[model samples]
Target: MNAETASPILAPPLITFDRVSRHFGGAQGVTALDDVSLSIRRGEMVAIVGASGSGKSTLMNILGCLDRPSGGRLLIDGQDVSALDTDALAALRNRRFGFVFQRYNLLHGLSAAENVEMPAIYAGRPAEERRRAAHRLLGRLGLQDRAGHRPSELSGGQQQRVSIARALVNDADIILADEPTGALDEAAGAEVLALLDALHAEGRTIIIVTHDPTVAAHAGRRIRIRDGRVVADEGDDRRGSPATAEAAPCRPGRSGPVRLLGDVASAGRMAFRSLAINPLRTLLTLLGVVIGVASVIAMLAIGDGGREATLRRIAEMGTNLITVRAGAPGIRSLADLTSLTIGDIEALSEIRGLAAISPERNLRTTLRVGNRDYTTMAQGVWPDLLVARSRQLAAGSFFTRDDIRSYAAVMVLGQSVADILFPGQDPIGRQVLAGRVPFEVIGVLAPRGVSGGGTDQDDVVLIPLSSGFMRLLGRSHVSSVTLKVADAGDMERVADEIDRILFDRHHIRNYQIRSSTAAQIIMSDSQRSFALLLGAVAAISLVVGGIGVMNIMLVGVTERTREIGIRMATGARRRDVLIQFNVEAIAVCGLGGVIGVGLGLGSAVWLRRLGFDVLITPMPAVMAFSCAFLTGLVFGWLPARKAAGMDPVRALAAG
Candidate 1:
């Protein structure tokens, strides 16, 4: 070599190993490097050669900062690296050393250009800058045309070229090659060695670890390791080992807000790319979250719809109304059915704040018009039934109070009864026999639909109380009394006054009074509880989906072990790996959440079309989506932690 070439080789040592020993398992376990001491100067090409299990690869790993020494100090650029943390070592590898692996170690899902940009991403380079740099490096390596191709699409030689471009992307000063030509054919291997030679020619330190003598012959110096120790050192007798210098201070690079945002963007892109590779698996993973969110949304909407419909129906039944029934806690006798009388109705009329009052005398009786006879409920009520129960007339007029006083047999038919008894015809002025007692239909009540208790409120016949009692089966007692309050605020006080009057008359609490407002509150509370219960059950499904996410992520981490090692070797910190894996999980769930919301809305619409009450609100959709996101976060933790805590050397050794 010329004097100018020899001068750079004789400078201060760039890497020094002082009694370094690396033991796997424990101190008594297998030792990969035993009390080894060596030094390499700047701008030199060195080769470490050994057979299988001879510790050459271990030595290369320790030298490249991918693995740590167990018992001794390693110094780079005259500074001891033994005390440095993992992130500090990562920064050291990023700023100073680049690695080229035998199998190329190119991420399968990333494009050639994207693979080459990996190191610069960890270095926090701008996206456009990294793209330009990656393209430049690929072009220099003669693979620029294949920049958009994935690793699987490239030949072995082209992939190796991409790997070399990746190594050089960070502008590192030292190149560490471990069996770089092992997987390539002879011609491809020669081309790769030639690339290494060209790199060495540019004043960069190069270290090659291989078992092949032909590959080691390209280096100027050769060192042979065997049985965890250096057995031979040849071809560099002129250069002497340099002393270790003082340990220098190092601070790992801290990512700023912009850099963090950039990292998130990069992670998001990578997550989508990874998911795109195996679409079936991604879809399967998303199925659980989608179903869970859809169930939650649909169920809550159904509950809300049912509640609103019921409340509306109750409001339609007069919210300021009260009904008094003639049954108490212990009154099960037949005479209890006859306990309420017209005198009680007259006594209740004496109370103030009463808007309207009606006495009901109901009996299960058969009505016959011509040869057609239908068994139905016969209700004997006063004139105030229309006002008290909020009933409206569809045709004709209601029975007058004089009709009740004179024992005139006139009756009003409910809508359903009118339809059944007098089909498609006006029942006004028509005579219907109530058990041989003829009665004229004076009016037909409008449809009231089904009550909350599942009873048809319009399936009844109304007659004058006095006529029904005196002329129809001689019944003198009333079944129930319906009362409408003038003011809703006076409902409780009015109920109390009625109770006192009934108690003074009957001398017992034999009557039960129910107010519409109280019923509304009770029904609302029950509905709310029902809705909450449905949500809780649906939330269980979401949790189960989250568990599915956790399981799939664990498998994904296993499958991407080597990729994790590659990123770490290229300067990615543990937090970066964690963020990458975690974001991938969240992306899966987020997409599922969107699809699930659409599905839920469609389901609700279908249910509504099928005659079910379904109410859809934005808040439920938002809540369901938010729950899906949180599920991903909670369940992704374990897999992300497992990936971040991986040992890079072991991970790289993984298939």
Candidate 2:
């Protein structure tokens, strides 16, 4: 038999519509369906024919459970469906009825086999079972070779065939077709009609709705609807006889951890697959999140690194150490240390907590060794200065007190100076010239990376204070005095007492006094404040990225409304769509977060290479990743909720 004729094998009515009515909005809104009552026995081919705007499509929607009636009792076999929830309806659709739409409504990004397996997945079939079923069905349809092809890769007829395969993959007993051939030419339409006819002959009850006369004529019975009402019923009145059959069993309820994980996996696959379809749009959308997360990590790393470096340098000077630089009162250029004689140093040595005091004087001079001259700071300090400033001799001991008592020309070279002037050779007893006087190299100080005040410490030459003041420059002035305190608790009090003593001796308050503890506290507070400010600024970009995600997802929902409808009609619940969108949002931002981590690390390395002390700590990295993920969830919820709340029929109708 062809599609137009049906066997007289009536067993029971598989679907019944009893005075069903559907209204849109309210009494003022349009009436889409009104008082429609009808039934079709099993194994019968029925066609619903009407012009545009007639109630035929509404009737089709109600039968397939894609929509609900405003008022009426609708039954599938013996079960009433009007009181069912959305999830229940979705389950009913998955196992009972398969739909063929006018536009095919196949998801564009999915392959033929994948699209055909959609209903099985919602029905909770195992992956292997779903795969086997897809294979069997594709083979049965004589389209095994085209199973991997996407909708865009197929012709109109092939795509419609794929849709038909998808509808039947769940082995649904009744097939509902809404203008299945409307979009096809004569040849493709004929091919689809032949398949429908073959299914009808196999004892499957079929309902086809169309406005085309030739398509309607192919049915054994024809019901014509007009203006949301049934106007005429022609052919086989006895086919409406009352009969009852058990409704298809619903799948297990959607709950539990396993089901949740499955739901998430499915949603993730769909989300990522859809993203893969339009690569450019996906990449462009990911840009904001990437840049924002990257900025957060990079900025925080730099600020923290700089702060730590600065603090370390300050700490190197000694927390309880204080320095007094000589100067005259009311002098603006106090940076120019005028003079602090040995008398002033001796006067300050009596202060409490004065553990070890080192009076220091420096002169900028050229040191000549073996016909090579190097411009360097020539510092003259007492032996106690080494112990006060945390210095140690690498080769020989520092000069004795006798060297200071007598005007000896013995000199101690800094580690860097030793390396430069006497490379690969012992400099002990080697002679270097300073200010036209030959000095013996007695010792070399150990290397210090970066000095307390942010200068290179290993680039000086040390001599006795007597030698520097007497023989070298004929001067008896100390440029600065560095004092080490006995106890950290009394550092502040000690500093005050020393300042008073220095003021009394030097008779000037204009001199500068630097307390290591005070400088440390100030630098630490400033660095913390600066770090927080940078973090706050970087967080702004994360917010912007989140907003962009929200905006783009909302637009995505609007654009893919029809696809949402198709999924709902096939068996996807509201939460399924919601999860799909949320997963997409998270995936995009999470990937960006990862990339931002790499980008941030790269930036840190580059800054370090540029001579900036940048630190990449774990906390900032953690914060950046957290911000990115949070942005997605916070910004993506509204759009996902909107999509989930949409009516399936209305979504289907959206352009």
Candidate 3:
């Protein structure tokens, strides 16, 4: 009797159930609650007691907005909740009722303080404000020193205290506790019941659902439910006057840009906390993204470096130089081989854009000096040959125009030929035999590396065109006419002019025209194709990494089903849960991307040290990072949606 029976209930019922019914497995399946009708007044301490499978828990769940009835209307403060959406239900739960579970349902990863601050977080309270409130709640609950400890570090009673603190974080008026002291010892249970008494003294409605008769005895009003029906109502009529509950209205969080940013920040923090729980699993998930991004950046760098090397080689051959070879377009018959003559070179020289022109006759022969013999290519040209081919003299001067006019037996030896024939001695003024013809070496050409065809370019000798034609070949026609255009932009025009002049002179098309400009174009196309091929290969790895992310997130959703239920129970909306999981996935990929970029640049430098050309640029790193982020966003969606779409009651019931 005492103080419990003395306190009168003043209410136009705060919660009402007008014949609510809940069923599982369709209408003919398990009937958890059937035609349940009840009304609880404001500031009343009511205990709903029943045995197992008696629908007491179902009634409590419906009262707390954690589950919806299949039939009939449930009202809160005279407002029907049957028409409310999931978000509206969640807001009502967060602002009106505070739940304390039998098992204490505290997230094992979060500290006590963090667990207490959860409701305030969903309430959209600022960080500083939530922190202070959480600490104050923990101190009042006698767990201030254990605020930083995780659930596993706390005893069962301490954890329950922390759960109570979390329930009261948002200052909810109606405390719906399901078996609050069922998992506690006798002393702890007494302490909890005393706390409930204190809350009831402050004019808050308290509803307890339990199977223990001793626990039900603490409430002023006892309602017994058997087989989903209220069998007996024992205790005095506490409803004295028809007075409405005047609890403070709850704010539905915030809105606009500021709220969105806060939600994002909170999601990020939660993501980190959850990921940190299993460090090895998080690391394994990150591995795939890291490898994919690193491979992309490194492959692109190598491709770009190779292209640069190729283009430089083409430039070395000369971009503006054109070659007019004496042959038909495809077939080079004996008659077509003699189509280019000295007249063609002279006519091409008269073209407006011609910088220098040289007529060349080539023959592969053995050059011998003092019994030392070497097989090499011998080319006959004028003094302008050096300028046309961009050749430089290493020691001596090139053959003069007088040597061409006089048909002098003088030649310039390429660096490779000079090294083989002259050995350690100077080649200038030395006599060398080319196909039994003695020739004086006037100069030695500087070294030119291997050509694109993988053959040495410095293994040749140059002689006067007149000497090669009259003394060696005994012919007037030259092997080829080489021209150096004044400007690269004028190459096409000058080639056309040369074609016209040559057609007028020979009266037939018997020569093939080629240019280094065409070679440059071919090289460019080849480089692009090679780069794309490399990129495509690397992109496959990125796809694999994305799949890995999807698989991990799916497994994560399954493993954290209970956590999701806990969040939902605390008033988190579906979108909030979605954003939380999505932010976790993105954070994983972003961290991996940063590490991958560093690894890729380091790998590029390592390749360079190993004598492999690698061009490292910022664009590839940025692109790889962006791709990683996109991979996370694309792959994380399905799992986040799955988590968000879960039924909170089923999720909470999941093991």
Worst-scoring 10-residue span by lDDT in model 3: 236-245
Q: Give me candidate 1's TM-score against the actual structure.
A: 0.86
lDDT of 2 at 589: 86
- lDDT of each residue in 1-655, candidate 1, tens digit only: 2223354235578889999999998856899899999988766689999998999989999999999999899999878998899889887888788899999999999999999999988888888888998999999999989999999999999999998898888777688999999999999999999999888766677899999999999888899999989988878622222221222122233379988888889999999999998898899889999999999999888888888887778766876888888888555524238768888999999889999999887778899999989888888889998888778999999998899899888989989899998999999999999998899998999889988678898899999989988877476888788899999899989999988899999998877887888777888888888888888988898899889989988998999899999999999988889889889989999998999899988898899899888888999899999999988888988999999999999999999
Q: Indicate the TM-score of model 3.
A: 0.89
lDDT value, residue 477 of candidate 3: 82
Top candidate when judged by TM-score against the true structure: 3
Per-residue alpha-carbon lDDT of candidate 2 for residues 1-655, written as tens digits (9 for 90 to 100) = 2333433454566778899999987989988788989887766689999999898888888888988999988988768998899999988888888898889989989999999988887776766778888878888878899999889999898888888988888877688998999999999999998898887766566799999989988787899999999898888623322231343344343457777787789878888998898787778778888888888888898899979987776655655788887765454433245567788888888887777888887778999998888889998888888768777789987898898898889999998889899989999999999969999998988887756556779999999988988877566777788889989898888888977877776576756787887767888899889888888888898888888888888888899999888888888887777888899999888888889878988888898899887888888778899989888778878988988888899998987
Tens digit of per-residue lDDT, candidate 3, span 131-178: 998999999989999999999999888998898888888888889889
Each candidate: what lDDT? Answer: 0.86, 0.83, 0.86
Provide TM-scores for the models: 0.86, 0.84, 0.89
Q: lDDT score, residue 405, model 1?
A: 90
Arranged by lDDT with the best first, the candidates are: 1, 3, 2
- Cα lDDT of candidate 3 equals 0.86
